[model samples]
Target chain A: MPRLTARERREGYQREYAFQQRHGKPFFPHVVFHDTIVSLIVVALIMGLSVLWYVQFGAIPTDPMAERTGGLLGPAYEAKADPGVLGYHPQPDWYFFFLFELLRIFKTPQLLIVGTIIIPTIWMVLLIGWPFIDRNPDRRLSRRPIALAIGVMVPIVLLTLTFYGSKVPAEGGAASTEPGAAAFAAGACSTCHVLANAGTAGNVGPVLDEAKPDYATALALITNGQGAMPSFKATYTEDEISCLAGYVATWSAAVGTTPGPGAATAKDYPASCEKAGGLFAGTVSSASGP
Target chain B: MSTLLPPPKEIAMMPVDWVEERSGAISFGKFMLFRNVPKDISWLQTLGSALITVFILQATTGIILAMYYQPTPDTAWMTIQWITNEATLGWLVRGMHKWGSSVMVVLLFLHMGRTFLFGAYKYPREMTWITGAIIFILVMGMSFTGYLLVFDERAYWATIVGVNINGTAPILGPALSYVLMVGPEIGTNTLSRFYSLHMLVLPSAIGGLIFLHMLLVVRLGVTSPPWSRMEPTEGDV
Candidate 1:
């Protein structure tokens, strides 16, 4: 169909105005009534959620670690912010799950901007500029196939991203009794690399489960650093590095399976743990009991 | 020719008439209340008003929260704990604010989707859509800034990542990151910065844009559902 001229569009709108003036209902009783019902529903829903969240929160736990373990709506609050500890996984609220998932897709340093800023910015620009871009005067859904398809596609894509984002494993590792495991969790390793044994799922560096680096490779990389991965040499002692490297080598390939090629065995962990001699030793002694 | 004492109804309406006479508010109120909307408008059209309602709830609850919320690192968490565990109905206020934010976002997207699918953004309503779009971005900004106000572990780390994401945006990335973080780290300044933005800056901007958006809506009038069979013909009247 030929595009409507500016004059035609204006006239069309004028006719619409006339028709509405003649046949439409008053905003006071008609539109206001619908709006009032919706507004009331929204208020009730918010209040209901608040009450549900409050009632579901069982008594606050005595254990600081378990404090505010919220109910269905989620906890009233989580553990206090401790910047010194970097082991915690960062998750945004549910609304941001789509962007959070975007970070996972564009995990590489080179493309991080694409996910973080570029894509979202472009989406915003497109959204704001849509009216100008789609100059077609047709408002009928059946008549505007492109608009209809786009309208459907955008929500589907966003919902898919949000679903995946919500499913992304928490990057924070579980508490481990093993000396090497403790060291790996305490150090900056959990912030970048995903190691299943440590329960970390950081996307900034290689997923150790997939990489399965041997002791020597893990040690060298940890000491020397690589692109986007910082060197730990300045921060960690040689022995501490060995303990971390051993931990990675032992667990990166997965548990209970023989590590591939030159990987450190579980037996090597005690020696590295002894040499590291701080948090590692503390964990070792605690694990051994008295 | 009127009697010394006005009729009882006029006496009762005296104050209202005086104010209306001075400000023309009564006429404007009448215009707003009595205006005609397209006959085919549906329940989906109420989403916009619903969004405004949620925002008003957020603002109210947020004010209640800010009364008790401490912005400093040392006391922020403690205050949050106090509000949730100690203050009467504090949990309810905070919970509503927390949950209300997500609701507002959901309603925002739904309203935007309705406008898009209905082709309500076309023609004279273009400005309305643009203003609404800006309001959408501002609402997201409000969300990002508000997340850190809780000052919990998750809030802190998420904000760290959030600021770092801002730092990834080419030439202005570092500057943006610096402004948000106020330094190399997320410290006292960062929390206060987020607090200011969340309550003061972003909310005001969104409120202003929403006013413009509503003005456009009232001016252009609501659209007829695109699928309605009652499409107005030019010569039908």
Candidate 2:
């Protein structure tokens, strides 16, 4: 089919106007009725969801330490924000999962901008510029296969991204009772590095479990820092640094290995934990008991 | 009719007539309400109105939530707890706002899909689509800024991540992050900034864009479902 000229397009609209005026129904009773019904349904659904969320989650717990587990919808709220603590995972609301997943895909520092700013901006530009790009006047789905395919594909891709994004493991696994594990978490090592024994999954730096750095390497990095990882020399005493290094070396090597090989024995923990002599020592005393 | 007294109906309409005579609001209301729309317009077309309804709900509930919502870092979380557990219907209001945000986003995508499928954005309706797209972006902005107002663990960390992501833009990344965070950290300044954006700036922009969007819709008339057999005939009525 030939592309309609500008004049033809204007005439076409005029004809559509006349046809609508002749055959169409009044907006008051016709369109307004449908709109009102849908709006009512929307309101009801929102209210139902609110009730269900509240009923399932119940109330916020009085005990701050007690778990505030949620039912289907999710918790009424999570624990209060503590900027001092970095052990918790950062998960955005579900609607933002696609962008969150995008960040994960383009994880490298250089490519992060592509996922964070460039791609989304381009997508928005394309969205707003779509009408001009698809200038063909055809509106029928069968006739406009390209638009239909795009229309279907965009949502499918978004839903897929959202599904995968939601599936990404929550960072910093459950807190452990082990003193060395407690020290590793409290020292804020879990904020930048992942370690299995500590149940931490931070991605800001190396995965200690994967790197499995030895005691010497862990001590040097912890004391002096390297690259993006900040030095903890001023922050911790010499003994404390050694204790953290030993903890990392032990757990990182022990993961996936038998007890006899490279694993640091349970006996090694108490000795170094005692030397650290603070919260680390306190946990050691508690772990040993009277 | 003019002898001693006017009828009760006319008396009741006197105030309305005064306003209408001054503003032309009556004629405009009639024009908006009684306009013709394509007969085959599907139920899917109602999604736009449904979105507006949800927006109104959000505004109403957000106002109530804001009444008790303190924006300081020290008290924001406590205020949310107080609202949820202590205030009457607070959970309902907060939950609706929370869940309503998701619903609004879903409906937005659905509504955009409908418009795309119908080719309603073509030619004369291009401005409508453009304005709608801007409104879409602004709504997402509302979601981002509003998330942090909760001040829970997830909200705080997620916002830090979000602002960091914004900070990654090529030339302006660091500057943008600084502005958004108001400093090196997400402190008292950041919380208040987000509150202002979520409740005041973003909503005002969205409200204005929505008005323009609706005005265009009323002007251009609703598009018929693309599959309908109707075609424009070049003949006098």
Candidate 3:
């Protein structure tokens, strides 16, 4: 070959290098010097944030596993009042949401596992095995039917499941006691809210110790309104309000009188929390009856 | 086959519009170069690289701090303070790790989106795409478990949210979360659980996925130029 100008020689070198890179001649995107720098920056940043959240706002949950055994949401033990990530439950961050929402669609509260585990596993399998199944060499997005469907479906399905998960109410099974009775009162309601266990005597709520204020007087306070106490008029039906008051007034008569966190010492509040029915036992039964 | 590598230079004299592309047939220069590589790759394309950088930083800082950090509430905050106030480069390492996580999450997200929009997940490279997705998920899980290890308010609440949601899990949820987090309350067990997960489980998954993702990417070749398939708009004039 005849000698070429320096410029031509340089161009040829550059072109050759470029061609080699494209043909997979040992050129790796990740092995570059800058890649090392970039990787350092990224890994450092993520790890740093985690540590910051760890050091500054990580959570040491008062209830790590969900053992709110009794009523009253458990005693809160040693709650650390930091701005930890645990409290703000948008979810397992973004990646898991699509799957989080999936279990929710199943309906049963206990079925959340299907959302977190099974669905995600299935999704992973589908995603990983997708290439083997879809052998088309076409890169056009619109033409790759299987790929297109998967691309759309995985997120859509995952997202749908997450939306469903979000909608699910926080699971709670403490169960409202008393069919027609003010079981809360019988459930040691007087200790906290004050509705007359054995003549309610606590400042937690407007004291109901005074009386056996007949149905009408009690109705105004319990149904319409009371201090620091929102009215139950709307939340409870006329019958419920009446029955609640009577249940409160007589629970002390049947049980006794005591302050408590859950069921007011059982003795202080007649009937076990689980047995207290919600509806009225009899219309003409107690004087607090509506 | 023979290329001389020049020392790093601050080429201010050359035209500002062009990237610094030297050609002296240097040995290392040749190894570092791309032959026929697409020209469009830019700073934006370096997001994955950036993420990997931050992730490694996180791991380094985290391991160092893990040496001194205590999980108990009474000792947790104090230990952290001790690390920051007493330990060596504790503050910088911790701070970098903290900021590093945020950067990683953002870069990974950006990287994933780029992959999706560029049709980088096509036939031969689908595994790479999938591995990237798994890395994204693992990053989140790492964030989650790691947060609990920190044992702060946000972490506490986040833990509650975790537990509450986990409690919603089917069958053995209440029991499972109990076992995972080590009981119904934040105690020694909770810290241990978080610590193990943060240091071990999450990292392992992330490591494996990253390996596979990188392998596939190298094998498939960074996507080429669309313009290559067509005639050059201006042939060397």
Candidate 4:
């Protein structure tokens, strides 16, 4: 082999070093630079859109008290403030709403992790790093089965989860007088219980709203265990049994509306106890579960 | 001129076993030094290696982080705080997991893209590609489910979206959902079900699919360099 001069050797080293830096994908490929620029532009556009909404449409001030704080900078702060805005009802934006919906649906505190960190973490890894992890040279749609499957399945799953989230009622936000009642309606009381807005049409047990039984009658059925309505005396209390019986009876007709000669005051619950001849009406709603 | 090349070694050759050569010596040094290489490898092969290394990182950090995390609503956010503040290097572990997931998804997609553009999905590699796709879907499912575990406001609301979607099937929507949540409330049953699906079912499915995907990859042989394909040999293989 021809012997290389010292200069030639140094030149070779420089060339090799440059090659190592670039990894042979064609030097400064325009696609790389172009992709980077496009990404940046998109990000900037989003920011610009937000800023435009704030500046041109005029920002809704966040705090009115800043002007009265006794400082020169206070007015500027107050100018940027739109006081008494509870911040749009404490919700995330559309992009993150699916997750937010998930949290709402996940009523039980114990299963929070499934939807929170674990699933999101998996999605990020799979979506961002899939190409790196599944580096194959196949180009055909049929041959690259994993890619095709993933391509389709991911959207399906995300869409499905999103659907579920949308349907689930928000938790703890709008004051659920009794959320578990919905759960009971889901299946437990489906065959035997009857709630109208619940859309339940069970024919087995006496209609909940129609019962309109007083606290005494309710206590007797719930505690002593009426026919078809099993005795919940063990699982319930004189008070709870009384409440549950009242719950069913109220749904039938307003509770304590005794059509008999001896009835409690309709004078107290004018709005609540209104049953001249009507039964209780189930007030528990199914429209609150996420 | 027709001497027949000495009858091609007629010493009772015993029909040599093809498997014998594969049983050669193996050691860490050999792999690192490329001692057993067929001398035809190139930079394109590095993608496979990178995938494996990153997967190991994901699994290791994921397990470690999970040990301290509390999945329940009452403690989920609080537990994350502890991981960040109380546990030694817990933030790093959690961050790695978080970042690692993003990185993995990006890489996996790229890998799939590479395979597609290169036409590596031809012939014997079809199953491999399919398996990879399944794994990718699983990855997404895991991600969506995980968001709920944080027990934050967003997660709470998002699950409603999840259920409604599940309830979309033709006849079984409502009933299916009722069974899925195990009593229609966000109670213990729902949490346990989701947790089991996330930790056990999904991971295990992913693990199995990964193995099959890799096996198919190795069996099919790394797609030859693009240049090599252009310069077709007489034997084709």
Best by TM-score: 1
Q: After TM-score superposition, what is the CA distance of residue A59 in candidate 1 from its true location, in Å? A: 1.4
Tens-digit lDDT string for candidate 1 (A1-290): 56887898899898887778777778988888899999999999989999988988878767654348668888888888875453565678888889888887876556767888899889989988999999878888888999888998999999999998887465565835555676676666766668766677666556788777778778887786543343456567777777777777766766543443435343455576777776765364455642
- Could you give the CAPRI-style class of model 1? medium
lDDT of 2 by residue, B19-80 (tens): 99999999999988888888788598999999999999999999999989999988888888
Ranking by lDDT: 1, 2, 3, 4
The clash count for each model shown is 1, 0, 81, 119
Off by over 4 Å in 4: A1-290, B1-48, B225-227, B230-237
The lDDT per prediction is 0.79, 0.79, 0.52, 0.47
Q: In angstroms, give how far residue A17 of model 3 lies from its true place.
A: 13
Scored on chain A only, each candidate's TM-score is 0.70, 0.67, 0.37, 0.36
lDDT per residue (tens digit) for residues B132-154 in model 4: 77777787667656655554444
User: Which candidate ranks first by lDDT, i.e. highest?
Assistant: 1
Model 1 residue B182 lDDT?
A: 93
**Predicted candidate 2 versus true structure: per-residue lDDT over A46-95, tens digit per residue:** 99999998888755577863336579998888888865453465678898
**Candidate 2 local lDDT, residue B68:** 91
The parts of candidate 2 lying over 4 Å away from their true place are A64-68, A170-290, B7-9, B231-237
CAPRI quality level assigned to candidate 2 from its DockQ score: medium
* Residue pairs with clashing backbones, model 2: none
Off by over 4 Å in 1: A62-66, A168-182, A185-192, A195-205, A208-290, B1-3, B229-237
The sequence of per-residue lDDT tens digits that candidate 1 reaches over residues B30-115 is 99999988877868899999999998889999999999999998888889988998999898899889889988988999998888
Candidate 3 structure quality by residue, lDDT tens digits, A68-131: 1212211211234342211122233444445444533532324434655566566667655655
lDDT of 2 at B86: 86
